[model samples]
Target: MARTRPTKRQLEGLLVTALYGATWWGILSSRTPFNWVLTVASGITAECVRHSSGRDRLDCLGDAFGAIGGISGDVETGIRPYTNGIAQTKTQIISHALKQLPMGESLQQRFLDRQGVNTDWFEGFEKRCAVLVGESKDGKTFLLKWRLQRFIEQHPDGHEYYIGDIDYGRCHEGDTPNTWFDSPVGQAVFTTADDIAAKVRAIAQDIRDGHDAAVPTLIILDELVDTMEDMDRDQFEQFMRDLKTIKNRGLKAGNITFVLGLHSTTVGETGIPQWLLRGVETIWLYRAGQERANFLHLNGKNIDECPKQLARLPRSFNGLRPCIVYSDKKLSVKAIPTLDFGNIEVKYSTVELSAIQQWEQDHWTPEKELTVLQKMREREASGKTPYSNRDIMPIIGIRQNQCVRSNEVYEHAKSLILALWESSKKSEG
Candidate 1:
């Protein structure tokens, strides 16, 4: 297409030069339809020539002369192909962006199936969320670690682990090999239930709204009872809502997978509802005992042999234990292996409650800041003070340069968040 149209003075000069001694009044004297058409066509041709480049401008001059003389056999070729090429290029870009985003069927699964990774361990789903439910000493942690190790090993493109509730006396706390700390992302060791919920909520939103490729992150949240122990009924409902949204929608992004561990599958015991559990694609039932019946019902199965197998399962602190695997309406008993983290030994430092870690800095937006401030406000209303500087920094997305001194974190954020809230309220009013 033409880069720039000519100015009024330039066009006037061009018309004068092209028409020789003929002026605007001279053309208007004809006052015929054919003359009016010629006038408009002549102006268009002149502008095209003025803005066009190289050989195209030279070819446009013949068309310009032809328009002035009212010739019938004039050819105007270059601009048509130029404009068409631009349109085609734009169409190609749009088509490429919409390739992964489908209108009818899901293209995410197709692309993942094309990747041809291992789903043998996953039961039914490809890389979606899974849950491990069993007694405390029933090797839930070890099996999850093994599955996660396999997930990381299978995806040669790399993966990360963000752990919540790394219990002090849990199986592999000191043994670093194949554990959550093996590839622990920056400050991702979540100590409190609140921090865990907040991070998961933020990540779910990112996966829902983002178009860029995310790193395949396996968020292993252990012991739901402990995680949601402090949340009241309303907060628990919101947390469940967030969890359900992510469980159903987060997996298709080809990243953002979860391996949540539950001590009991009963809704009353774990505070997790049947609706949420029914939606999970993969479930590992290890020594779940009475919870196995509820699990069986959720999967639309009533097999007698499943219970017999569950009853006969070994009950002791041993190696790998037999467990029931339910997925896609298929139920089978399989032995879950205990992961050996080898001779490598490392112990975690003392963990304090509500010690905030770094949230994703790049994805923090104005809307997210609003959410953070609201959370802070809730704590303030409850008479809960900010625990540490680390808590405020990650939640509010505060950079180091923003602070004048190290000692002003809690007080500064308290005053600032309240002020921002007031200002926002005024603006809305």
Candidate 2:
């Protein structure tokens, strides 16, 4: 006869019984010298059983032990858990993440105040059009994501649209594009190259007619060159034309900003149109070859400062290369540290939570989970906070109060964050 399977209730009872037995043994054995060892062994055993069975009930038990072990570790180190995930109105994601990173100066203040520019310079817009180019693993996408998140946080009232092959396949997959277009945020997000071009043209016409709203609109195009590669020449040219028109009219009124991210090879091999390159007022150069460096006129004297800047670029401990930001008036090289969201639990709005659940349902699989776990371990080894699907799920409001590992870092980091905020105010004053 085949073995009988346990019911869900039976499994739950077994898990509770095992945990209670472990706790009792740990407590009773505390009088002995090997008490700590026994306690630790019990936790390890729980985890082993979780993996051994591959059953949901055992997995829950393992997670419970993991949470307990994690909390115990945090308490042992005196590191207070920073669970402030309630999204703040003013770039809270960046600000909260910054608290966990060690930076010479706050990035939020530097971008907003210093850099020899002011918000008024862009008129009502936060910034102008910029192209981010880098070699693979050089952190172009990371920087773009950071900038985009900051923009969304800063301009809550503004419409935000993103087209990319990142986590979401909204624009990359055929059906997702239609799904996105049907969503509440669809009005702002474009699903195709043609759609984006058309939207830009319409916005430009509205700006020309002086009928555009005062609120800013930010659009991020990731891997633009690659995206254009899939489009016909006419479509590409039309998109470029629309971009140029938008850059001239939309930028001055401070009503729109376009952020384009591309690979260095894409610019060299495919050759971005001169008009699009000229429209880029801000350039961020990551690790690229000499040929790639040649495109950047950093000094206006053909001094080849790009190569030198690229050489001096810092390598992040977490395996990301730094980049230099060059503008018309000022140039600065900075490495954006990877911020850990592990300790910071975040809550999302209803719509956002629903989207996250749907995304999880669509993408989550055993193979994917294993891959994510492996990556998380690598990140942890590099002294960075690793964000797993479990961590993100809670932040996006899919789940609640998930215990992401704490770094046990000092609480003083909060003061630095506050100081950065004060600096922004000081600059304004």
Candidate 3:
């Protein structure tokens, strides 16, 4: 059919519609504004009804709307609410699209190791080093903070520390009030990669020299892969070198722990060296889609040894998020509980110096034993007695030095014992 030219009024209406469409699109999202264009055409149909309300008017609004859509404004496609009730029908279409996914997913639910869907799989990691893999805003930090909270509460004798490209120096207040992560270790602990590198080297060296970190301690590194990518050549080398030393010593020492967070598990993508991943036997998986293939390429083994659910984590706001926990070469699905910080920000983590000092004193070491006499003097003032050397020495499994010099020291000990015996006898008499 041949198309007729639009009248002056129709042309003006079309121009107005075009202008509104352009403005709506420019100010909003990337997708084209199709719904809004149809809405504008509906307004034009309303104008047609207004002008010809009583004379030669279309019988119904459905025909008018359809005519505005068609070339000659005459074709009617049924009900008054747009063509074939598309506006209402769209809702049903969307419901079908989203609803069927979860239903189908439930049917395909298979566990790699007797995995129950969305069940809480408490991860047990025997190794000291662990890797947490997740993308941005996947609650990686929130989960990390929760782990730290649990560690602090459970291990009163142990200490917790946080280091990262960003300072997560806030209490874990998003969920529980008075959470263990309430103490922020301060932003100074982790503000820059260079500073982090230096601090790591120093702490690791101190542990090796037996100067500090006598008790079990957890050291957390957040977004280290991102930091590595931003490093200079020399800086990266130094940082990795320091990290390697720290990882090896910390893992082997058994008293130290390492929790490293990265967006990717692969060296090519994450900028984490192969050696770093090599030392980590346990990898806590998050909602990363490229799970199986990347781990296979990185470690020559499957890190996604769990049920295939990570790729399609259920969209949620306040529910347990699915995570695949890989440990001891075993794969399993875990519904990791989420943490909420409640917008609390603490600047510095308070460390109880007295508690740490008390631990150091109670911690049995040969060097500490040499100061036993001084400590005994303090104890005696409070009507407290120190452990007898003889009893403690046996349990200590000391290999005695029986040289002449050593014998002289023992003779001096004997003289002191005899003197004490004489004093006791006098007092008894």
lDDT of 2 by residue, 58-103 (tens): 2343233323322333443343234222111111322333334344
lDDT of 1 by residue, 1-429 (tens): 111223343344334335421323335464888776676766565565455533332233222322322211111133443343332232122123223232301332232233222225544333567777766445667666665656656565545456776463345333433336344433556766666766676666556556322456677787777778876575677677767766766656646678788776654656677776766654555436424544544544544555433432322112334466666656655544444554332233322322221233233333455576676567667888633344455566565455455535444555555666677568769
State the local distance difference test value for candidate 2.
0.46
Q: What is the TM-score of each candidate against the true structure?
A: 0.49, 0.43, 0.46
Query: Which 10 consecutive positions of candidate 2 have the poorest summed lDDT?
Result: 84-93
| Lowest-sum lDDT 10-residue window in model 1 | 68-77
Using TM-score as the measure, what is the rank order of every candidate, best first?
A: 1, 3, 2
Ranking by lDDT: 1, 3, 2
Q: Which of the two, 1 or 2, has more lDDT?
A: 1
Can you give the lDDT of residue 382 in candidate 1? Answer: 83
Candidates' lDDT values, in order?
Answer: 0.50, 0.46, 0.48
Candidate 3 off by > 4 Å: 1-127, 157-160, 167-188, 251-254, 281-286, 291-293, 298-309, 312-319, 337-429
TM-score of model 3 relative to the true fold?
A: 0.46
Q: Pick the candidate with the highest TM-score.
A: 1
lDDT of 1: 0.50
The residue pairs in collision within model 1 are none
Residues 1-429 of candidate 3 have per-residue lDDT tens digits of 121234444444334333333344443443456755655565565455445543222122112222233322223223423453332232122123323443322222322122344544444442256777765444566566666655555566545465664434433323233232445333324656655655565556455555556456676777777666666786677567766766777645545776777777754666777666655644444435334644653442335444233432332313455666654555555665555544434334334545323333233232333344444445556786543445332332322442133554334343433444455448659
